[model samples]
Target chain A: MSARRGKLWSRTVFLLILVTVAGVVLLPILYFLTISFASNYEAYQFPAKILPTFSYPARLRYNADTENYTLLLKKGADFEAVKTTSDASDFSLYCKSQLNVLISPPAVQTLFDRAKASDQAVPIKLRKDFFRNYVVFFILAEGTMRALFNSLKAAGWTILISLVLGGVTGYILARYKFRFSTTFSTSLLVVRMFPAVALSLPLVVYIMRMNLYDTPFALAIVYSVPNIALTAWITSSIFKGISVELEEAAMVFGATRLKTLRTITLPLAFPAIVASSLYAFLAAWNDSITALIMTNDNPTLALLVYRTVGSSTIPNLPAAGAVVLLIPSLVFTFIIKNYINQLWGKVAL
Target chain B: MSYLKLSSLKKTYPNGVTAVKDIDLEIEKGEFVVLLGPSGCGKTTTLRMLAGLEEVTEGSIVLDGKDITHLPPRQRDISMIFQSYAVWPHMTVAENIAYPLKLRKMDKRAIASKVEEVAKICKIVDYLDRYPAQLSGGQRQRVAVARALAVNSKLSLMDEPLSNLDAKLRVSVRTFLKEIHRNTGATTIFVTHDQAEAMALADRIVVMNEGRVEQVGSTREIYNECGSLFTAQFMGTPPANIQKVALASSRGRLVAAAGGGEGAMPLDLGDRSAFPGMEGLIGNEVFLAVRPENIAIGEPDGVNEASIEIVEPQGAYTILVTRVLGGEWKIMLEGDVDFRIGQKVSLKIDPGKVMFYDAQSTKRISLS
Candidate 1:
């Protein structure tokens, strides 16, 4: 074959391989979203609907007497029988239903009611679409988002604290020779392998005694503990590869130890510190079990997602929340993909 | 007054290897001294001790009238260019040259001017902004020189600094270093195993051997009148040849063999009363030490004959190896004197150039 033909053939094969691999990876995600939005009736039908062809209708009870349903506090004993008993004279129940159940937060619920009452009481067709599921998913997602925000807040603090502490500890371990330097270095790894969950009960009791339970501060400390050894070992190895001669050269030029570290040694080590911080961030972000065990009232997204998953009789909404949960981590990993490769190369044995 | 002096220096490692054993040498100001020896000869150790990099196990190192053995390397005002050219790889040539001045807290403007001045002298001005990894080997060596010079220290210690370069570059750098030493007039202590470098660059060469000083003298003095057998063997390219010869008394006078088979030839001993120690024995053994270059092919009045065994034609001179009586010997012939192999050729060894040593002790004896 001619060289041009040969080149064209090879490129076509390469692109075909890439596209096929991408299609395989992306297919399951596309399939899950398609089925999640399909009507529940259609989903359970003889042959499952791969696409939404028709909308399903849902039924809700309204009182003919009061013409309103109370949203909160149905007197505990009448909680299950609240499907009836609405009377037109009970304006408080009507206002409560209008504000709490029929409308959402961060906006005037009355405006939505006005928009609804000015139109039909059916309100946007009452069709059994993904919005009903989305409405529930959004609430859970907000809790998840708060949990996400809390985890991010805790992780941001963890990475910052770990980088400073871990960098100093690593430099001392790698460069200086003290009487017990080896013993000190070995203990870092020992602390990392300590089972965190084994200490969780005691930690929770301690946090409660300190009045730190359900706070992001306590969760951040828990997350930072596991990262100390990992950051130390990784940063120490990088510091070891940097020749002490370079630092001494700076010292000869009148730089003190700290000055030398700031000017010469730290610049060379910046990439490694960044890599370690990313690792610490991911560790804190993905730690669900610790966050769940440590917190109660101010639960993170992982805890909220768990609560949503646990309470659901059916798994569809939770599965939808799970799909949403994976998005931020995916986007974060994609954005820092190059740094991940570099950090991996630096830390890998 | 000497700029640097080492007073009875001693260095012993932790495991008890005495690298430099009681060495004493004084270097005058502006003088270039080279410590030359084979590996493990303690030359490098002594230089390090002087540079304040290595600790002195015993004795004091005084530089410019101040005792500095206990001082650190940076405080001693001594600059050292390592064998590996210890240039910081991350820094540019300008930055490296400016480093010492920066250490002294010199003003930025002055440091820049000094760096430019030294860079121009080393002819690396154009390469100032480039990092060390970008420069050629010769350029890096020049940068190392510039960095050392920028400090303007009292003493400069160079440890085989040009050993890494190619031969042509080595010669150029060697010449440049000599010129720099002369212009700056800094007391320099260079260490090298290359004899040619020591011979070319030193004002006084201190020959070391196995942790002790073998000889210390000018280049000509060491070559002409070597104090030990090691010095004589080490200084020359082909080295001096030593052979055992039977000295016999003729007419109650002692003389060594003059190269005829089995007592047929004899050398005249001028005085009988002299060398009275030979009275008890008419025959004894002695060592004849002569350099290869001192021996010639043809007879020159007081000469001997030996059968040529092999002839080697080097570019400047031809060396003939010949067997005389019981043993083989070598002689250097002037120019391209192509004497055929296995030819019985007349050879001349100038008696004045030959040295005498005791056969058993290998110690120099009374020449008369």
Candidate 2:
């Protein structure tokens, strides 16, 4: 009975830890999503909302003694007078700027006349266009779509270059023994020790000399420098796990060396290769400092999103941009998740 | 001309260690030859050289009248079954069998038919669409065999393929492999450390020690007529009993005396005429090897007397262990004969089957 109670206690503690970890990771993402859908006015509201709402309940009243119209917004159960305006254009501009609720001057004037006629307080429902922030970010922000394309191209080239060069180096390291092989493998890790930001500065000179500056290809070259080492380190262990006899079997059964590599070694190492490609993709897609130093006219989406954070006082626009930047990484990870599962399953065997 | 010939083949690693030293062999067409030795005895190295997986450091390999000493494995037109089976995990069983045929540029229809044929032979037809990961180890081994068979290459090489299976599975697979070889008639070179496996499967066994071949002959010849002390100690379940003793004539009968001085006892080895040319080496020390089955236990003969120390019943036969020449010696008797420990018995060794070896060189000495 004591053992059973102890097990139950441990299970409860484990569940608590799991929930805490999930909240810590997911709450920030949830907040970011809500802010991306928020209006400029909702962005500054105190005690921020966890979820976005489509419509706000409020009342419009005419104050005959003050000779002005008053807007009362519902906060919880009570209403509070938020703004007062007599001019139609002023009311229209206030709704558009503060409320993110579009109202034409003529429409505001009609509402004002109706409120003036009715001595009682008039109920009004203010509706907001939910996806306005996202639409405006793409349509109004210059070079945003181009930045998305640049990030994609850079990541693609990085995957291709890193897989081709690192995979061969990894296979050679795993399969062969030579003088100073340990030293050579250790030296690859040494290359990864230098910060990518430090290397990007010197690489820009070569990029300019080669006339490839401000291009996604130049960004790929810088990203691949560190990613190649990481890919080699990851793939070498996986290649070692694959038996050499498998490759030799292919060769003995009429396959040439290159054919053996293509058929046997690469397929066996594919899950690791896909995993390394994900590392390479994230390195190129999420890197902003390197892009800041290496690129000027052609910026990656991550760089654009970073610039958006500094320029905007309201967080909604930049949050929308960040959400846009998150999409490709999520899709890439989702697609290769099955392959990673296979890697784990194979290891268990 | 032989179907395959390796002339003075040698292998020396870059680390200054020689794995194979001056191996010369000729193989006839359709012969199943087994290279048998313990681990690190260069048997696998010799097989790898034949498969072109290892570079021949010194000599030439002529296959079907063509010099292929430096050629790569693919150019050699051979198929090998690895000890690990080495079946591709990603491919289905059918694809694994069809890959080599496809590489040889066979048409799709022919490849499919060939795959079905070999899969039927290997008893893996029911698992044609299943991947290797889904198959058991024994089934994967069959897939590997089927893959090698589908190629129908000039030569087939197996490197300890049965060592990975369980004991019972190993015996069944051994019979299955022998049956396949009989039906296929492909010239095969099999490498293994199991003496029984080699004896069971080989048309001829090449027994190796260290880096060179000790002897190469049929199973019966290797067992009954060992050319070297290594082969005699190597090719049996219980192994031959060998002892160093001095040869002397006792009353005109050849006798081997063990345990020098007054404590020495003479093992009467029948008439002097049985071993010709025995007079020259009188009183000289030589190694005497006697098979356990050849040593008969009987009433006290007043010549070679010993007390039984232990008895082991193996269902089919019984082994009696006794002290002889200051060492434990085993004797085999049929049908679990009642022999109790500490029982006094006399041992009579068969004179015609007795073998003598030169103590210095460890080589067999022919007396007839």
Number of the predicted model whose DockQ against the real structure is largest:
2
- Candidate 1 lDDT for residue A46: 44
By summed lDDT, the worst window of 10 consecutive residues in model 1 chain A runs over: A95-104
Q: State the lDDT of candidate 1 residue by residue for B1-368, as single tens digits.
A: 56677888899987789999999888888889999999999999998887665789998888999999888667788887777776766567898888778878899999999999999999999999887777888898899899889989888889899899999989988999999988998889999999889989999999999888888989887777777777777777777776567667666555566433365444333344655445543466666667888876664345355677888899788887876535566677678886777676566556556665666766666544
Stretches of candidate 1 off by over 4 Å are: A1-266, A269-281, A289-349, B242-289, B299-314, B317-347, B355-368
TM-score for each of the candidates: 0.68, 0.96
Q: Could you give candidate 1's per-residue lDDT for residues A229-309 as a string of tens digits?
A: 778888898899777756655554445667778867876676678678878877776667787889876776666667787
Q: Can you give the DockQ of every candidate in the order shown?
A: 0.13, 0.58
Judge candidate 1 at residue A13 and give its lDDT: 100
Tell me the tens digit of each residue's lDDT in model 2 across B281-310: 889999888989999988986778999999
The candidate scoring highest on TM-score is: 2
Model 2's CAPRI class is medium
Q: Whole-model lDDT for model 2 versus the true structure?
A: 0.89
